[model samples]
Target chain A: MDDARLAELYERYGFLVHRRCLQLVRRPEDAEDALQETFLRVKRYGPPRDGGATLAWLYTVAARCCFDLMEKRGREPVAEESQLAALEERGDGSTEDADRRALLGAALRTLDGKTRTIGVLHYLDGYTQDEVAAQTGFSRKTVGKKLKTFEDRIRQLFAGRSHEARR
Target chain B: MTAPLPPSPRGPECPPAAVLEALSAGEPTPDATRAHVQACAACGAQLEALTTGRDAFLRARPADRFLRQLERREAAAPSPWRRLFPVLAAVVPVLVLVLVLGPRLTGDGPGVTWKGEAFRVVVSRAGAEAVPLAQDSAVKEGDRLRFAYESPEAGHLLVLELDGRGGATVFHPFEGTASAPLAAGQRDFLPGSVELDDAPGTEWLFAVFSPRPLQAAPLLARLREQAGRAEPTLTCDGCRVSSLRLRKAP
Candidate 1:
């Protein structure tokens, strides 16, 4: 956690951390704050002891910081219209991707910290269940169950939104 | 039974974004993953996007500038004392006044005895032997420095620096808002070393040791306020402050 190592880590991964923060918070300023906070925590608690991917470890920390900031501010994750439109335009066929992308923030808020992290690693970051298990120190079964919970919650959110639209 | 969840958009053959990001950063990646990324257009495009995004982010917010912003934000964050002020005012007015105003009213209250070399600093320069720094040692910019301390009793410690530019920064447990715990007796070089910044003139390094952890933000503020003095010190009731002065040429 010395200054030299920290500076090196920041140089290497700061952008990835910032991008993760920005993805979650959707505000440049807040992302910057979370990015700093992420590094601060890294300084406080050093890096992962196990020989996992440093970038994966950083992404989890950045996501947690973003979620904490959002909760502290008592604000919903800002879903910009432009971002939604981009997702919509990039959709393969169904609006599933767009809906999943848009509802992820709200759904994530409803989850416990561990489940949320697991969900983000698996769905958002595209980590496989085994990779998520390795990073999280959870068994493959636990990862699968947590992912099921996350998917169920996402479905509930999408269902609620659909009902609202129909109404 | 509930329907199975949709598969990840990355597809079955593609590697995860984390793998791609690691590849983009030039970190070690599996040969299979690297070959897949190289052969697969989608994976290659994703890696390209990651690289492009990283470049854009670094361009927008360089490390030095971002670090400065972080320092400012840390300085500006509200301390625990500030958050408790209203409660202290309502509940214990006399105690609050004594704690708040007593030190300022009295000319620099009781000073702790310098318990026989409780703190130490070691400097390492490229192609040079590592040397332990004494009081008023000559140091140059870019000399990496490490710190150690010897304490009779276990306590919380903060190693703070007042640079030539009157800027205060935490050295040990770098960039934290509070002191880190220290074990009793002699402890050798702390975990990390800090390279001296380009700021020229006299730099003061202080090791503030206390029975309890002290908030670094308030101490940093005090150091900034007293930067004009020959030596800046902290006023903690149960805290001992050891200082090392280093002369830096402009």
Candidate 2:
């Protein structure tokens, strides 16, 4: 597509771009950055006329940007044993931010390192699970199992967090 | 053609998040998802939760306003796109923000006053003319001095700016109200308001907008052309204006 047509597509897809990024990036401004970067790529390499793969392709670019942005911030949200330990020591927000973070953290910590990475890069990043599997080199079956597990853990974690926050 | 959002499904007896997502995507939903959303409590809560988020995020966002400005910008912007025109694209949105946020945020150009000997000129878009309401005119007890207009589309201003100085020079960029129509061949009596500190001769200008050291412009050309030099005046004899010997370039 031409730049104008690409821009039209970009605008139409902005909300999804933003929401998907928000779950992983933890900040609205960062999500906006990811979105801009996504469009900048689309601008550089004209997107497909197929349109079906357009969102998937955009998601891949955004996924990479998220990793880069995370790396830039030196907050690679990996599930190393040490990292999981650090998560347990969590900060003092104790409010919704802390509570949400803790639930997300516990759920994230439970996944195998690769699985967790895929889950965050997909659901949290707004990538389809298939795209996540493709980017991370996981089988689609593995990615699906990881996401379902991730979801269950998160539900329990958030439920627990909500209970704690309530008290 | 884009299809309407599917009827909502239920989970948790509330609307579903998926429904909003589908709607946001401007896509059609499957019958199962729609039925599930309408009856499912969990899905219903998800919908409410997501809708609330959408409302908060999109609501807090000046998106609607920005979208309108972008529309106007696209309309007015020239085809040869350049990265350097960020400032130009921003003009409409900035104008919309100021108006939506109220006058204090806008700094100046809300109300400007010029005292003509025969009448007082207050330049604000209140009446029809797409022109400033003239202070000196056949004022009647109910005659309003001016009116404002906001172009329906965003790019009008860009095109306005490019359409050349005359038309572009006379815009109340933020004024988005309806325009008052002047009669057929009815000469425009008063152009709008005059600035006290403009250089000694009149310079035809569009409404000048700025925050610091706000000033007004003479509506002479606009006035003369509006009504064919029909000495714009006050409707009442008892009324008084600040000054009448307005500095004329002529």
Candidate 3:
């Protein structure tokens, strides 16, 4: 993309990308770095061709950048307590939502990249399964299957954490 | 049988965050999504949060600064051909020499006299248009200042301030231990602004541009020693330094 178009893109969507990075990394400095890296990737590969899904596309890119930064620092993804609390508050006040929200970062670490991306799109961003499928270019069945796997992994993680806490 | 996925915490009628973001950006969205976002309190709050967060981000790290950082990062990486051709590596120094010396030889560029490094300070008072500060201009305690720099090469930059009461502080990167990366050949304003404190004295703003990252700790240490000097100078080998003096009044 040319400079003007790129500037316009940054002006319009940079906040969403920065917010996504902040959610994943939970550090202002690291989020800024990830935000820069996301735009650099955009400058290299160009924005997604699908105009409608641009924010979703940027979110995925920012998430990948945040994950890369976390890996580079040799640290596991750790959700801030405030973020987890916000997640719980936003959800229906159920134990399942609480468990899922509390263990989300750990559960996401345990899953593969594609599944984690799918999970974030559906659970975190509140995209419907159909919307997730459209954004990811996957069939609805595959999106459902991946989301199911993600949910199972979260449960497994919660069980393991509970077992450890009980011990 | 595969278990059904959990329903979204956001209601079924609520649009995705992406859709909300797009709507916030004034992009075209379906009427149904717009109506739903307007009617749903949760969705409305989400949209408002997005807007507030965006406004904060723009105020802190404006688009120009973000773009400059992007350009610097892109310029810092070597191209595939540069890696593949060892012979081409020899040509780079010659190219640098031409870029550094060519402007002086022709006297064609506006910054030819400054040796390709320029530092400018723009000051904004309450409800007034910002104007670039002339050398040793008078400023007030409540005045806000933004910095801009131009360089002949891509490098790391540190903007430091030496206040009248013998205090030295890093002005750019606001709170970092190292110099921020700067793009070459553009006179771009740095991210964020600095508001003058209630210190009444002559303050010196220094822009240190170097090809390699410089640690702020050592630089500040040296500046601290020289803070009381009538004219402070720092020794940074192979780095260009530009200084702006301001008389800060109470």
Candidate 4:
């Protein structure tokens, strides 16, 4: 992609990549590395023609890079809750922060590729459930239900955290 | 980021999750989501909290500093080699003359005669060829002499001089490819080469073709006029130096 397009992506969706990676990796610095590496890869190989698919392609690349980093770390293909809580406490980045991220990361790993990918594109990346459906070849109802279920699970995760974190 | 409301037959029920979702990606919330957020203290607090984190991360690396570092990288690249034309013109004639006369290094003895049309060079054995050539080669101190050559027959004889100078001396009679060792200078020759140390000065003479009794008289006269009072210099102008003579025929 040209620098203008790359810069536009940086300005528009840069955070989703960072936050999505933070959800997977749990460390801010490592997540930053994974995101930066992902963008750099996008700069190199790049998405072709379809501007509409650009975000999804970039998201896919970022997702792959984050997974590669997690694999390299040899942790279960997901970030843990307590670690997510620490990142959230360190960040103060809203209630939708760390453990919610960890729970999402863990839920995604448990899902089949099609369902998991749809869930990530819908929730973590903020793509509409329809958009997630388009990217993952899933039906809209399937994406909608998956998202609602994911949201319920996130609520459960936070509720559990409130009890555990209560000293 | 706007919260999508619960499915409403009459209107939308904006959910905090959808609003927070939009906000997470740094986009503005949908109007319905904003109305929902305005009514909900929890959604408002979450917005305020996430925005604070976003703002802190935005300034982590200033654009000015990043651009400055890029400028430094570009500035570090070496300038395209510029061989000043005048020195080049001067070096050309001398190189041609040396190539024409077959460049007599005359050993390391007291006599090192470099014979040419306009001037004759007889060097005193007292100095190193590098020292004196560095002092006299066409380039000024710190400048380099780039030598170009094409070898003909065995034992290549290339004239070493500055660049456009090669282009210049074609006005004179010079020959040989400096691609290999001439024993005269153990170093300095590439597909091209540049003088490492100093400019070779006044001692060099660029030879020209004299056609008094032969056929090229008119050409030499025009060339001599161009040469004027200036010492013989080499040029890359297209001409064969061996065909050009320095001495006028009787």
Winner by DockQ: 3
In candidate 2, what are the lDDT values of residues B13-93, reduced to their tens digit? 332332345544555667776777667655555556545655565555544443454455456646655654786688878
Q: Candidate 1 DockQ category? A: incorrect
Please list the C-alpha lDDT of all candidates, in the order they appear: 0.78, 0.43, 0.76, 0.47
Looking at model 1 chain A, which ten-residue stretch has the lowest summed lDDT? A87-96
lDDT measured at residue A70 in model 1 versus the true structure, 0 to 100? 82
lDDT digits (tens) for residues A67-123 of candidate 4:
777667765434555564555421223444543555565556545676667666555
Clashes of 4: 51
Say which candidate scores most in TM-score.
1
Give the TM-score of each candidate. 0.55, 0.34, 0.49, 0.38
Tens-digit per-residue lDDT, B79-105, candidate 1: 999999898778897877766666557
Off by over 4 Å in 2: A1-7, A48-57, A76-167, B1-20, B41-45, B48-250
For residue A158, give model 1's deviation from the true position in Å.
4.0
Q: Model 4 segments beyond 4 Å from truth?
A: A2-5, A47-58, A77-83, A86-111, A121-167, B1-12, B15-30, B62-250
lDDT of 4 at B73: 41
Query: Which is better, 1 or 3, measured by TM-score?
Result: 1
For all candidates, state DockQ relative to the true structure.
Answer: 0.21, 0.03, 0.21, 0.05
Which model is ahead, 3 or 4, in terms of TM-score?
Answer: 3
Where model 3 places Cα greater than 4 Å from the true spot, the runs are A50-52, A82-106, A130-144, A155-167, B1-8, B75-250
- Best-to-worst ranking by lDDT: 1, 3, 4, 2
lDDT of 2 at B181: 30
Task: Rank candidates by TM-score, best first.
Answer: 1, 3, 4, 2
